[model samples]
Every structure is written in structure tokens, then in C-alpha cells.
Target: MRYLIVILALVMMAAPVYAVDPSEILKDPVLEKRARAISKGLRCVVCQNQSIDDSDAQLARDLRVLVRERLVAGDSDQAVVDYVVSRYGDFVLLRPPVKGATLVLWFGPVVIALIGIIGLVLFFRRQKKYAAEINRDIG
Candidate 1:
């Protein structure tokens, strides 16, 4: 029983995670593949941390439909993505372009890391100075 439970858990963990419903799938395999790829890169506004493809939010579903509609209407993959970005801003993309206001989004972590390193160096230097003072007083 324990082995069966462990196997079940492993299988569940290995399963691919997606929320694509049957009705959302396109008829053309090529289009469907492209749509899926695009969806995987779209951020769900309602669930800010989840991609539209993996989100079950109504907004994600709507975005998925919109993508399909654009594709069917002869929009290129990039055009469909651009359309969504235009309507919702760069935040709609999981990997937003490193331009404009999003330049902060791309570089904020690096800036933060540098700040942390500087702070640590200053803190250690202060601690060492205090230690030296204490040792001189003891001597």
C-alpha cells in the first residue's frame, strides 16, 4: 500500500501541468501548436504570477480565444502577441521586452543584488572595526 501510494505521488508529480480546455484547442495542428506556445508566454492578469496557458481564470480563457481569433484572421504570431500587449500593456507578457518602463523590471534584481553586497561589506567592516577597538581596550 505504501509503495502504491508512493508510485501514485511520483506519477502525479511527473504529469504535465496545463489548463487548456478541449474547446480552446484549434482545429489546425500547426495553429494549435503556435497558439499553445504563445499562451505559455502570456501572463494572466487576473492571476499575476501564472501564465495564461496554466491559469484557469476567465480572463486567461478569453485571452486564449482572442489569440485564436487573431491567428484565424491571418495575424502573425508576433502580431497577435503585439495586439494583446497593446491592449494590456507589457505586463501581459510573461517575458516582457527590456524597453521603456520594463527596463526596471529587467534590471531591478541586479541592482538589488549589488545593494545587498555593498551593505554586507559595510556591515562586516563596521563589525571588524568594533572588534579591533574591543581587543585594544582589553590589551
Candidate 2:
């Protein structure tokens, strides 16, 4: 029983982790490849942190089907991406473009980190000055 459980666990671990169902795959290998490439660059809106290709969310599945449909309907890779962007906005992209609108998304973390570092430096300096005053009074 233990050996069977171990084998099952190993098989599950070895399985591919992609969310793309076999039914959603395109008949044309080239188009399927292109769809997969595009999917990898798209963010799953529901999962936020996961690419649609890796997310098992219902919204991700819908996005995957939409991408395949667009490809079959003769949309270029860029066009398919644009269509999704038009509907879902830049947040749907895994790597959003660095533009005026997205500047906060790109730099907000750095700005916050700088603020925190400055605050820590100020705090430590204040503590050192306080300690020096105490030492002077004690001596």
C-alpha cells in the first residue's frame, strides 16, 4: 500500500502542470504553438500572480479558449493580444508596458522601499544620539 501511494505521488508530480485542456488545443500545430506563446505572456486576471497558461481558474480557461478562437479566426498574435488588452486593459499582461499610466505599478515598490530605508536611517540616528546623551549624563 505504501509503495502504491509513493508511485501515485511520483506520477502526479511528474505530470505536466499546464492548465490547457486537450479539447482547447488547436488542430494546427503552428497556431497552437503561437497560442501557447501568447498565453504565457498573459496574466490570469482572477489569479493575478499566475499566467493564464499556468492558472487553473475558470477565467483563465475562458481566456485560453478566447485566444485559440482568435487565432482560428485569422487574428495575428499581436491582434489577439490587443483584443484582450482592449477588453481587460494592461493588467492582463504579465509584463505591462512602462508608460505614464503604469508608472506607479513599475516604480511604486522602489519608492516605498526608499521611504522605508530613509525612515530606518533616521530612526537609527535618533537612537544613537539618545544613547550618547544618556552615556554623557551617566559619566
Candidate 3:
């Protein structure tokens, strides 16, 4: 009975699939594959860190529909991304272009690392100075 209950629990825990409707598939499988690849690179605005293809948020669904619509309309993958970028700006892209306002976003970790190094140097210098003073007094 315990084994049966555990099996039932495991079955219940399976995620309910929200797959795109079968009729929505494009006649060209290649185009659909490209569309999916592009969608996976777009972040869902309503889900901070989840890709649009992975998120179930309303905005993700809307973006998925938009991607499919663009694919059916014969837009290139980049063109579809450019359209969304024009609408929502660079944040929608998983990898935003490194330019202008994004310079800091691209370089922030390096800047932080330099700052940490400088702080450590200064701290060590202060400690060494205090140690020298203590030794001088002891002598």
C-alpha cells in the first residue's frame, strides 16, 4: 500500500505540459527549429531569469506567440529579435549587445574586481603600518 501511494504521489508531481498546440506547427520543420532557438535566447519580461521558451508567464506566452507569428510570416530569426528589441529594448535579449548603456553591464564585474583589489591593497598597507608602529614601541 505504501509503495502504491508513493507511485501515485510521483505521478501527481509530474508537471502539466503546456506544449504549443499541434496545429500551430509550421509546415517547414527547419523554420520551426530556428524559431525555437531564437525564442530560447529571449528572456521573459515577467520572469526575471527564465527564458521565454522556459517560462509559463503571460508575457512569455505572448512572446512565444509573437515568435511563431513572425516565423510564419517569413521573418529571419534576427529580424524577429530586432522587432522585439525595438518594442521592449535590450533587456528582453538573453545576451544584449555590448554598447553605450550596456558597457557597464558588460564590464561591471571587472570594475568590481579592480575595486576589491585596490581595497585589499589599502587595507594591507594600513595593517603593515600599524604593525611597524607596534614593533617600534616594543623595541
Candidate 1 positional error at 45, Å: 1.3
Model 3 C-alpha lDDT per residue in residues 9-111, reported as the tens digit of each score: 9999997664454555567899878877988899889876988877878778778888989988988888999999998889899988999888898899999
Per lDDT, what order, best first? 2, 1, 3
Across residues 1-139, which tens digit of lDDT does each residue of candidate 2 receive? 9999999999989967578999999999999999999999999999899999999999999999999999999999999999999989998898989999989988999999999999999999999999999999999
TM-score-better candidate, 1 vs 3? 1
Candidate 1 wrong stretches, greater than 4 Å: 1-17, 111-139
Q: Choose the strongest candidate by TM-score.
A: 1
Model 1, position 41, has a per-residue lDDT of 96
For all candidates in order, the CA lDDT equals: 0.92, 0.95, 0.85
Error of 3 at 124 (Å): 7.9
TM-score of each candidate?
0.68, 0.64, 0.63
Which candidate has the top score in lDDT? 2
TM-score of candidate 2 on Cα atoms, chains taken together: 0.64
Q: In candidate 1, which residue pairs get closer than 3 Å at backbone N, Cα or C atoms, i.e. clash?
A: none
* Model 3 misplaced regions, further than 4 Å: 1-21, 115-139
